[model samples]
Target: MAMAMAKLWMYCLLVCLGMALNNVASAQGVNPFEPDGGRRREMVPAMFIFGDSLIDNGNNNDLPSFAKANYFPYGIDFNGGPTGRFSNGYTMVDEIAELLGLPLIPAYSEASGDQVLHGVNYASAAAGILDITGRNFVGRIPFDQQIQNFQTTLDQLADNLGAIEAAEALGKCIFFVGMGSNDYLNNYLMPNFPTRNQYDGQQYADLLVQKYNQQLRTLYNLGARKFVLAGLGRMGCIPSILAQSTAGSCSEEVNQLVLPFNANVKTMMNSLNANLPGARFIYVDIAHLFEDIVANARTYGFSVVNRGCCGIGRNRGQITCLPFQTPCENRDEYVFWDAFHPTEKVNIIMARKAFNGDPSIVYPINIQQLANL
Candidate 1:
């Protein structure tokens, strides 16, 4: 009887250990933000970026607007100076440039002499898919206006290189669009706005997605073929939203809005693929990647999953996050760079996911998959 009892205890212990081991393996294996298995091949000769602050390398800051980043502490960690990026260091554009063996694409607002011949960033801090969304944020450029800027830049490029050569260069280029976060967060969620108290969450999302599709179709008409469309990240869990919600937990109401918005984006991409000729629309799921990092922070060596590295106060969502503000000693452990944007380390993780061909996070295809297409 004693021997039988001993065997039973040992078996149970083994089972528990096995379960723990499996959990650990699962955590490590399924990190969607991890770098892809592809070697950095020169798939696209150049990259043109459009959208909002998430990918903005400092275009809006140069313009006469409150939504700017061309100041001290904004780029303290990036080349030891302000290069117009919202983060302390390099953004997705810079990483993509490195991956493609190209120089950093200059901001469209930068001096004409300083602009890069190959690429430019038309992203403004408060820009969005719709012109109406731009008015919500102080000093933000509208989407249609941004397209005009791109047209001007393209014309200049054509002047430097012949029109045919410029066309060829653009054909070999990849265009990356990262917008919509501000439209939902700054506009629809504002206390004074009717959307905050009036519209159903899903209905509001549908409206935004409809606007996004129109803007994307416009880009496609403008000779943009190879494309990367980044969806909204985990906005509900962002420190700014958490601070606003009654409970410190992520706002499910807001998350509900995000789900359908992302779904519509996926549907739009599918339609574009089916209808448009040579259209390679890739959707990068920024929200899912962010959720994975926050849910399993330990696997990513992050100790603190919540809270921004910058100060947290009543005005933390707005007035705080300045150059003089206190920053975390180890930024890698913190998911947010400021109240609104991501830290450089977190952006690196996102870039890796963007590189991967994961369908859940990256749709249509990733950098490797796009190479074949």
Candidate 2:
């Protein structure tokens, strides 16, 4: 045990020294990791993703739930047709994986054997931060359950590569978490659920932030060192929320409800970065980015900002895109793909922004910078 502690200490010391040298090289406008030809290489060892349908690749297909999306028009543009991704093509994490020079991370439900070595996506449709948040969906994997799945993956990895080696590999990988949207969309805002009557918006945000802190700490304890926590996007402008509006406009009330949650999460991220040893945390200002895209829809080549490409009723959101439904001809010019999710184009833009955009949107540092560190 003493020998193991000494070895861990020596490894940490060397990592810190290397980071310091990298910072110096960065200040001199030179990237030590980059070759002369500027070819992109895998930035991190691997990327483990956790979130809801926004990033869920295929974790909900086998589950007996209403949130399943492994059918037509869902993965219409993907090379692998109808692979359970909520979007038409790639998700935000898929884009990030591509930008990182890594293949798309497979879903936890589908990942097997050596596939687990690269990474696994535990995000599920309708999953939320709180355990009870997604009960309406009946079979969704909440944040806690997702972590358990990751633990199972870790056990498999440990059997393949010894415990110490697995830990070392995980420490160098990226942990991307984009939860909490379902906590609001599927729980707090749902009339059948008593979340609204139980607590006001601010109190609910506080409760979520508290629980999220615990959940993230649990990951840190299990060898996750680098984290990218994506903040909730502009839910008010979503097709579903917009459909509820009498006038054809964004719902300010709904948008205001999510502000506290995003703000609290940012505070929690800063606290975690300060408190956790060897752990780094960054926040993605998803709301701001979404708003920017909506505000300048034309600039981003999006024409329809208030309706879905394949949904029905008002704003094409009252009923989500039905199975076998034909999507819009100009899929590239739409902001939303369904009532609750954005189009692949929008996902690509969001991923690009979070990957290398300015620090104002992706707080502290972007994904590329986080990978380098």
Candidate 3:
């Protein structure tokens, strides 16, 4: 035990020293790796994450959800093996946290003590904004429930730091939401659900946005101020959808379904920022970024953008990446990691763009600017 403690101390010291050296290097001049600043900096004290498998990290590991990704092959390219991130390595939030000069946020299920100070990730695999969205997955926490979990985290924070300090800390933190994929994949588009028969694509989007509005307002009331809401990516381009396509191309019909959701969210964001005092919301154009990547694959070093890196059946997307499955060797050159998730390489690209891009990709203000504000 004493030896382990000594080793831990040494490791922490080395990490701290490396960070100090990185800051020194940045202070001298610009580094391409650090986009927000030359010198390393912490833009926000904490960053609270929400949503589904896209940014899940490891929150669903203990849950009974089939969406969990803690087994082998899932994290083949990450820090050794699986840390519950859907990506091969880091998720978008992981890269975003690094950009913020903060350590990776702990899963809400595992966080304790000072861990909450940095923030907590409440995202779960197969979870969605609607309570019934991922019901097929059994134990996945929905967005509303994720928020409720966060509220519990807040209560714990208040317990540790007192109410005033906790509230102040929360008000200044960045709130990130990246969801809605499962709602389309597992609920609306699924033949088992009556969603398609009951409502058209645009009307479904409105329903989602309305519930989303209430969810975001709830977060606002809970002291969240800065927000980064990632618009849905082109669902039709995913490996799962491509596998279902007879032409082995992106399904324009499925793609059209998501367009209205992203559009309405932008309008909702504008309204939210305008009405909520001190609230600053940044809308990230994920579909735009992804479409560009697919269109210009060679420019981005991707040789295969339609199929996933791992899975079974057509496009390796009929099923999610399976356990012990030998993932593709050239993971960096692929866009999708599995049926429903992007490779870590792509995740980094998305995070970086959302962190610093202009209005073309991120509207109003980018994450870096929002963090600075």
Candidate 4:
């Protein structure tokens, strides 16, 4: 009875807190849950994306890689249809671009000439911090290569707008980067790779941060000032990891493995902000944001959390969604779109939260505040 009463009190406390937050939103005349809530006109001049499949857009469409998603079912709900995006609809960055009052940032592979003036997305499927990270996927562009591609884009901008104007434009743009998941999913965890036999989890995290630090510095040198670094989400809770579980539960071991990486990256944020003058870095707490959505799945209108909306075997994760495969009718109710990615609804929620959420979700300041700065 005591335990039950304690639980009840905790529940009531959460309810009261939610009500208070809602009341604050009402008083301020800005509903955070709404899409247009805190949008104060166009925020950033442009947004340049660099990451893995989570925000790839269409960089892998023409690449001879197995990780490409330019087929049916992948973009069944999307207006363009299978534009190399892993999700059925929009990626998190796509939603973020819209929130910033800009059109979808074109992929680096496809954008040409003045098309990249607004910004360019160099994210690719199966890319990682390490250059040799995604060798299994023959044609995937690694993080270093992506940076080189951005340099090429910068040259193009310089040629078109002159060096001074290009520098000023890029300074006001947002650099949205979400990497490291492939380092864990494709390199560290894969049996085919020898990453695990290499350094242990802590050592690996250090190596990644060490390399990532230099890479970010390169981007800073190239004129990127406002940086939004999205940390790894709960990879162990995804359908691919859960499918490997006999008990059909999230892989706690896998979760613990990546914790150090996120912590180190968070610590690195303060270092970058302090050391790199004119460079403002903000860390997005993807792990916590994903956890809250899963924990409160019902409240968020999600019914299926452990399995993918479209896949083959146990938890529908043995194989990723195939071409022409029909997905769940209720896409909004399903959290996982494939064995490894989230649905469009989930993307919208995450983008919104990171854009305007409190300090707990996005440290130092959220995306909106960072843009204004």
lDDT by residue (tens digit), candidate 2, 24-51:
6455442122223122346676799999
Per-residue CA lDDT of candidate 3, range 200-255, in tens? 99999999999999999999999999999999999998999999977788899999
Instruction: Write candidate 1's Cα lDDT for 260-367 as tens digits.
Output: 778888898899889988778888888888888888888987876656777556324435367566677787777777777887888888887788647877875786
C-alpha lDDT of residue 160 in model 4: 67
Superposed Cα deviation of residue 78, candidate 1 (Å) = 1.2
Q: What is the overall TM-score of model 1 with all chains considered together?
A: 0.83
Better of 3 and 4 by lDDT: 4
User: Cα lDDT of all candidates, in order?
Assistant: 0.73, 0.90, 0.88, 0.89
Q: List ranges where model 3 is wrong by over 4 Å.
A: 1-41
Candidate 4: list runs displaced more than 4 Å.
Answer: 1-41
- Of 1 and 4, the candidate ahead on lDDT is 4
Query: Model 1 off-target regions past 4 Å?
Result: 1-42, 111-114, 134-136, 195-199, 314-319
lDDT of 4 at 119: 81
